[model samples]
Target: MPDIVSFNKGHYYLLGLGVCVGVFGLIATLEHWFSIILSEATVKKLFRVAVLGLMLGLLLPHFSHFGFSRYFQSHGYISCDAASHRWLHSVILVYTKNEMLCKELIEARK
Candidate 1:
């Protein structure tokens, strides 16, 4: 049987907030430099670039999560067990639940 996953509103909210802030921060920093280079660009060009950036920003969290999981698994910070990958899944869940806990756990292993 497959494991059933549960959703926590707080976790999702935190993740969403984190993504939004991170994306906006990146956009702001990039815009400062891009503005200098594209000072003569049209509004339409800026709009297109913003759209593309938003799309990529939405995927950044997932990509970062995948990278963290891979690193943890390879470093033995998480276990491979029961042919289930249960430990790693649980760790990821805890991560979404409380990011501080995840950071502490990872750093504690050092």
Candidate 2:
């Protein structure tokens, strides 16, 4: 059987907060190393070029399909009951719950 999953509102918030912290750390590290390695002008030019290229890549055919999931969800991909509560019970919340579960499991061994 498929693994059963449930979510609480606070859990989803924690997951997004975790991901935001991770990405913020990543960007901070990139900026720090970049300043150490290059002049201000070079870093500015490179960052502009690179981030622009990445943005354009998101518009390509292969990458375009990523938006379909959102579209389908909005268009009622499943029954109303499931669709209505999908946002409340997202993968983000499930991941956060799993993390808490793992921590509890580890502490229980003591």
Candidate 3:
């Protein structure tokens, strides 16, 4: 087994990614199930964004702290802990924007 070391970036990175993905997935799933008030087009867009966001979240751990920092360095985000914020916030926007889309879809079928 690998040794446990303090201040291991890999450990912290995994933790951050996990939290972001969990939040994104939970909110998206909740919206899909409980918000039966979206349109098909909007639903599709949300689902698409969710899938892409999920993929990004899953791959986040593979990147180094420096990589993430540099990649998002120009997006007006400061500090080394911005990746987690970016991921979660991006997903949340997608979910919120498409919330009505899912509702419309369910409403149309009724």
Candidate 4:
């Protein structure tokens, strides 16, 4: 059977940090473009959102399996397993519930 894989915690944290930075940069760029100065309250709200995004990034791996499983199901494939690796990188793998179907999918890719 095929399996679904998740990344290590470090990878997720880095991704979250990147996302947080991107969000802040985007907002800053928009504000500059529109000649708008964010109030203290608005800046505080943005900071809150960034922190929340970081927290979500830390939790992303836990919920990622469900999303991948649903995507496979939508494509008429049943996910058989979800695995997390302790290696120093992130990876995504999709597997079908049936061995035959898994083999067929693998062969089709070749």
lDDT of 3 at 70: 54
Segments in model 3 whose C-alpha atoms lie over 4 Å from true places: 1-36, 65-110
Best by TM-score: 4
Question: lDDT scores for all predictions?
Answer: 0.44, 0.41, 0.45, 0.62
lDDT of 2 by residue, 1-103 (tens): 1122323333433444445455545556776866545557865765565555444443332333334344444543321222123343232222212344445
lDDT of 1 by residue, 1-110 (tens): 11222222233334545555665555566668666433435535655565555554455446665675665555444322222222322322322224444455456545
Better of 1 and 2 by TM-score: 1
Model 4, stretches more than 4 Å misplaced?
Answer: 1-22, 66-90
Q: Write the per-residue lDDT of candidate 4 for residues 1-110, one digit (tens) a residue.
A: 23432223355556777778977986788689887888889888888888877877777755765576676677666543332223454544455645666566556656
lDDT of 2 at 20: 47
Best by lDDT: 4
TM-score for all predictions? 0.36, 0.26, 0.32, 0.50
Candidate 3 RMSD to the real structure: 21.6
Taking every candidate in turn, the Cα RMSD to the unseen true structure, in Å, is 12.0, 11.9, 21.6, 6.4
Off by over 4 Å in 2: 1-7, 33-110
lDDT of 3 at 65: 50
Q: What's model 3's lDDT at 95?
A: 16
